[model samples]
Target: MDVPLPLVPAKILTAPTTITQFPDYPKTLILEQCKTIKDLNQIHAHLIKTRLIHNPRVAENLLESAAILIPNLPMDYPISIFEKLEEPNSACYNLMIRAFTLKQSPNEAILLFNEMCGRSVRPDEFTFPCILKACSRLHALMEGEQIHALIMKYGLGSKGFGSNGFVLNALIGMYASCGEVEVARHLFDGMSERSVGTWNSIFSGYIRSGCWEEVVGFFREMLEMEVGFDEVTLVCVLTACGRLNEIELGEWIHEYVVAKGLKGNPTLVTSLVGMYAKCGRVDTARRLFDEMPRRDVVAWTTMISGYSQANRHREALELFHEMQKTNIVPNEVTMVSILSSCAVLGALETGKWVHSYVMKKRMKLTVTLGTSLMDLYLKCGSVGNAIEVFRKMPSKNVFSWTVLIQGLANNGQGKRAIQFFNSMVEKKITPNNVTFTGVLCACSHAGLVDEGRGFFVSMTREFGIEPEIEQYGCMVDILGRAGLIEEAYQFINNMPIQPNAVIWRTLLASCRVHKKVEIAEESLKNVVKLEPMHSGDYILLSDIYASVGRLEDALRLRNQMKERVIKETPGCSVIEMNGIIHEFFSEDNIHPDLVEVYNATENMMEKIKLAGYVPNTTGARLDAEEDDKESSMSHHSEKLAIAFGLIRTSPGTTIRITKNLRVCMDCHNATKIISNVFNREIVVRDRNRFHHFKDGSCSCNDYW
Candidate 1:
């Protein structure tokens, strides 16, 4: 076949001496200059015509460059050339083995290695590393052990045959990558002289297996022995530090990197950012990220994720917008972080836009991304959207199922959540502690006291899952919400673990609801000792005292709160419209449309009052007059948000609101009336659970 030659300089093609006149190794120098497969084909044909294809250096170089070094070439080209050789040498075998490994064909590499062994070709030091790397990729521990035996049989171990550390380094790496970290450690300790690569292999092993402590200890030993380290070493240690939250050691490493003048390296700098970010020093992480000369997707994603982890969700969303301005495309990880931020802020429109973007970009609905989207919808009071995402997911893991179950529980679909949990169990998915928390929460919100007790016992007896404090809290909530105040208090006292402030607060809140002032006082005593300055605890107790006609006690408690400088957490609510989040604070006048919103709120109060809505002012100040208390109840954050929603959205549109605190009974009752009077569905996600109000009813049925 006539091979078409590529466009090349005439002077080079017609040089005074053709490549044939050069020595075999020099001929390879010419082969290295071939830019494309066509260029290589022209030279390859010329070499075959000139009877120079037999030269090992020329053949191996052509195969290595074309098959491995060159970009975008197919594997068949080199494999065909390799087969045409009359007697392929070990060098050609090594080239193909490496090509297979690097090109994501580790299986082929292993098969070729076995063929080489079957052909009785002697493996060299270079050959072992290539094959060992292939073994590492495949996690072929059995094959790797066979290779190790070959190493010993051929006297290629560190103790025998002209020992170089390359073979042993590869061996250690293979063992580590196969999850035999201890064996890797054993090999590492037996080394008479260790290279930087040797240390890195063991560190990688420890990291891959999540043995973070071993990494830290080995790094300490490396420092003590005065072993010189490089960027690889620092990156490894920094990763371990990030996972372990070793901020002090991570800081020292940062200083060392600065002293070594390695601060210019982007990877090392990104590692520093991750280390600081994981340790809750997001500000420092941002500073370093800002100073980076170049920020890739990974660096940007790390910083955004750091913000989400620290609960600085708004900043994460802001940073994501900034990232979009640049050329770097936000990947799935970036989307997950941004969605998490949107979930916390209740930015439903923004979350929907992100979901649309994912669809437009044709990104796969991976479990992580899908779960995040479901969470965003669930938190934003979009239960239908969340359920849709959950159903469309191609695969479901324990976490994905748990997120769905928890989201359903939060959305007041507790019965459905429990059904989903049963389905998950029938499918043989083991539930973790978080799953049970969601399950118990479903029972608690649905007022399934009997079912809650059954599962709480079944968690340990059937699944061997220990009941964490969260599950215990759910039980208390379950009993308390059902008006079993005595049983709830007994359950708290008989708990295996010591009760925390949250437990006492749960009981206290229940007491206020059930009008048990005596138990409320006792619960307050325990809560005060555990969390003295907690505003909610004090507020709950005060409300209970006022409900039982102890106005003096309520007034005295309010005075104590003021004297102690403890203020109630102001209620905040968020609603999304036109892709932007609008926040309403109690009695807030800072919004751009404050006058309009307040007018709408007053109008809403009038309409609901005509529908027989009355403000329940049990928690109001005992010193305030009835009119002042009623007026105060009218401006609650959620009520204002609902009024704003009624104004901004067209009639009949569902109004969704997320509140920072539990919705007060007055707002809840008024909202139910407002929903019926206005003929609209209002979904309010309080701090605890969802309340869907429509036609003079709530999803919780006034139980919560």
Candidate 2:
């Protein structure tokens, strides 16, 4: 039998005493009055001097206050106190463990628990909870499993050892934090009495792991069990809804929130905003945002990001400006959304302002912010600035490399883009699917067919990246752009994955370039099957028919389009002049100086014809005389936009135009002649590719 220690005398416990010539004070009163480290130290000296240091009650009180309640006291002080004790009790160990857990030094708590175990001190229910909490905090799965075995060995998991809801809840949390959600769920399912905290733990785990469907399923079960949820539970469910885009369920949850009068909760309201925004209801999200009594940085960021994702870039920028007017500061996320909007709008001036703001604020150049800057500069036609940003970035991820390469390819520097890809490889950075897409695109645009084929083979064989549909589409584009129409068709037929409409459309576009009527019809057949309502495919097929002198077939197709009410998307071109985008459609007369633009276009046509330009009337579909065809081609939207750009912009300043449709052959020929006659460089970005016309020659070399 273990020997029991003698109890301390009543005089030692209750009498007034002094240590080291200090004033006499009762030890209990001193311990109770101890609030700061100074008082604890004075009481500690008194205990040591009075020979009451071994008193269990006195030791417990000192350890509890110093380890937990006393602020600004070093943890080492309480740890030293515990270490000096001859035989510390479970309560003493529990106090220190809980202290370390709260202090975020969970490994220390584990060490203390290990020391407690080594000393053969049996842990009670409270001891297990604190140590298990430490395990959860550290995500120490193996140590937690060992502690779990100990709990079972001691019967502390059952009522025999007084293990209650707190212990079980900690157990669930520990497993969940270790990423063992299934095991946590097993424990949860076996529990006869589950607390709200238990459900929250499991739900949060599923959310953290991105098991969105399971989150919904468990939430449903939680409701069936009638477990009352708090703000945390609803927030998690709403997040899941946003991830899955379950708009209806999100609305129902909103109704529930309203029914429970929880609409006033800012956190839940933020979740609702994010959910509605992600589910394609920005108006609803904005309504909730307006209703909120207070808005924080996160709420503003959410709304801004939602608008950016919805392509409402103007609104996103407006909200960002509004956020700056308030006391709330813009974070990196806010800046990123702003830059994305600028990229989409090709707003170089606005993007430059944002970049200056970032420098003035001395914000850290993180990868995400740096990538956004690169994209903004690239889309705004400033390749030099984009390259400078890429080089200055302290870190570059795969996405950074991919963006630089794609930007180069898109700007018609395909050969330089391939060189960059080689540089990326020499740096030992692994290329992902997007990186390969950029590489293949570079090869395709530069007419490096053999090199493109080699990379496509190496992607799957060497890099172990299974070719996605995007890769297959790139290959088709490669073959099609190279005039290997038969090979492109063969590749599409042999594809393991089903070809999407984009792939068929790529083949169809190439068919039009080569005037391969049979292949164009076959590609159109597949495209129409996949996307029946797509007007572009139908228009392309009709164009192909009209090009081959089959007027009846072309007219039939056009009539069918009219009967189905499939309106062709009218061709429009946008030209940015003085930071304002000017949009023009075919035969558009909307500009204030429309008459001036038309006169300039007529004069340019005359000048180009003097340079031996002849209109390619085959590009026109009207069954009329050559004069009518030539007249129809003259008023094309891109030509009108070019004329407007030439008139508005200064002489010799490169005019840039963006078109919704591919540039027709007549427009292409006329643009080359105009570039030579006017001594100006004209850059046109069509839906297909860029056409850089200078001195009677085009960058695409008549291939496009």
Candidate 3:
């Protein structure tokens, strides 16, 4: 029966249906179901065959699918489809613009918005947030302000559409991202109402601008207003706390997080760990790290970095090795921390391993990482490798240049450091305070007093950099080392700021060197007044007394020190050989090769003595006979480390040693003789500077 009826109108039965004949299911619902571009294309063909392409609803659905549903589709597909629309509304424009913004083609979003405006489609609340976000992504303050102006022109800020939280938050974020924090703050202040997101936006902006104090203030205000805080708020505030070293406040925030059951959050925990570590609470940070249920790369890196910053290099390396055992891969940040530890420990072999790993992983030598590597090699007593790393770096910032300059100066290559500094200036790289510090140090080490003075003046007059306390210390060191004790005293007296303990200590050290008893007494007075608990100050003053044959006075001072319960920081030296680090303390005999090391030391001392080396007992604090003093100097920590290194390493291999204190005159003389006798290059990095001994001479030229 049906076939018979259809035979009367075969053409009508087979023809395409009208738009109204389609299913009642929403086009948007159908679009949502279209998971892929292929599905969307089928829908597009159906829309065309049903004569529904003219239906704005169907067209809008098709555009949304093309713009948002499929991954990595060409923008041209959406744009062409949108262009074909007869009268695309603001909603359609917003969809297209949002898609472009999401795809990181922010300029295209802006163009689409302009086209929508030209077509006379009035933008609504939804339109502005998308555009503002686009501006944020592009960091285009000018474009963001224009969109803001459009919003203002439409009176959107007063009520209904313009006062939307999303739009306002997006506007604030855009301004902040463009480094226009003040403008963002003005808007934030005028907001009649705000969500937690608004507060977070302001906090993040302050953090990005390095206005950590303002971040703390905003957090306090947020707390006072009883606004709810999330993990983002805690992370930002914790970071501010760490920067300011506000440990007490950070602890309270930590307590708050724990109370809110947010401590389990990996991000908050990592921030907490970093905060504690930066605030000088590394032990607490480690405790939190251990308690974490699971650690991400950031957490592990933060913990490792915390230890490194605290100068706990052994722990840092241990933690780094532990991190390797896990599945989490190390990023540039982790490698930097590891390199820093190796630099401090002078673990050249370990540092080489890290360098090799960096190459193996194909990690790009970013400015920070490259600079860290250079610092590591230089600090580990391999100036050649450091220079190589520096030259191969693709880019150099003020910090990178400063690290190389400082490294050269520290490694007794002062003239070369100055040359590098001048080259940096010729390249128009503006030097920072640290840069000036390094250059001044170079001038001091190289005996360039006049150049040092000129640069010191030029720092303020030419570069507008006001010298800090460290710069003044370097200048005093320069004059003091050159035997201009009176000039140093005058300079300290005329300083614009009050001299700190370090300044007095530097002067006192110079007094000891120049045998200026009167100046030594005055410097010790100021040093004790500033740093009453500093054992080195008392020790140095006692040594000066002993040097002047005032043995009774020296004895009385030692007794006073014992009564005051102040303990000296024991001198320790470390040497790395065959990928192992050997540590030696003053008078230490704990190494497994102790007998061989001492035998080598005795033999080396005999040869040095035969070569006209005389043991200078000026550094021996004990009120003992000259023979006892000579024996004490022979067994010093650095000498033991050197003897151990000589016994372990191959012939002619460079011997590198790191000491916690300055090398005494006796050890310095003996090292020069040993370098000549053994035909080896000896690099000794002490508390202040480096000494390169070779062929009966030192690189410092006896100035240090």
Number of colliding residue pairs in each model = 0, 0, 1
Clashing pairs in 2: none
**Candidate 3 overall lDDT versus native:** 0.88
What's the TM for model 3?
0.82
Residues 1-704, model 1: lDDT tens digits: 99998878656645333344445454455456767766677777777887777787778777887788778898999998899887778989999999999999999999999889898888877888899899999889999999988888877444662255888888888898898998888888887889898899888767777788989999999899999878998899999999999999999999998998998999999999989999999999999999999999999999999999998887887898899899998899999999999999888888998999999999999999999999999988788899899999998899999998998888888999999999999999999999999999899888898999999999999999999898899999999999999999999999999999999899889998999988999999998999899898888888888888988899899999999999889999998888777899998989999999999999999988888987898766678899988888898999999999999999999999989999888888899999999999999988888898988899988878
| Candidate 1 lDDT | 0.89
Question: Once superposed on the true structure, which residue ranges of model 1 sit more than 4 Å away at CA?
Answer: 1-67, 70-164, 170-180
**Per-residue accuracy of model 3 over 1-704 as CA lDDT, tens digit each:** 45554346544554433334447555755566767766667677777777788888878888988998788888888888888888888888999999999998999999888888887888888999899888888888898898888888786335755588888888888888888999999999888988889988888767766789888888888789888988888899999999999888899998988888887789999999999999999999999999999999999999999999998998898898888789999999999999999998888888999999999999999999999999999897788999999898999899999999998988888889999999999999999999999999999888899999999999999999999999999999989988899999999999999999999899998888888888988998998888898899988888888788888888898898899998988889999877677899887767778888889888888887888888888778576788888888889999999888888889999999999998888889889999998899999999998898999899999888
Cα lDDT tens digits for candidate 2, 638-697: 899888878888899888777778888889999998899888888787775667889989
Write the candidate numbers in order of decreasing lDDT. 1, 3, 2
Q: What TM-score, computed on C-alpha atoms, does each candidate reach?
A: 0.85, 0.75, 0.82
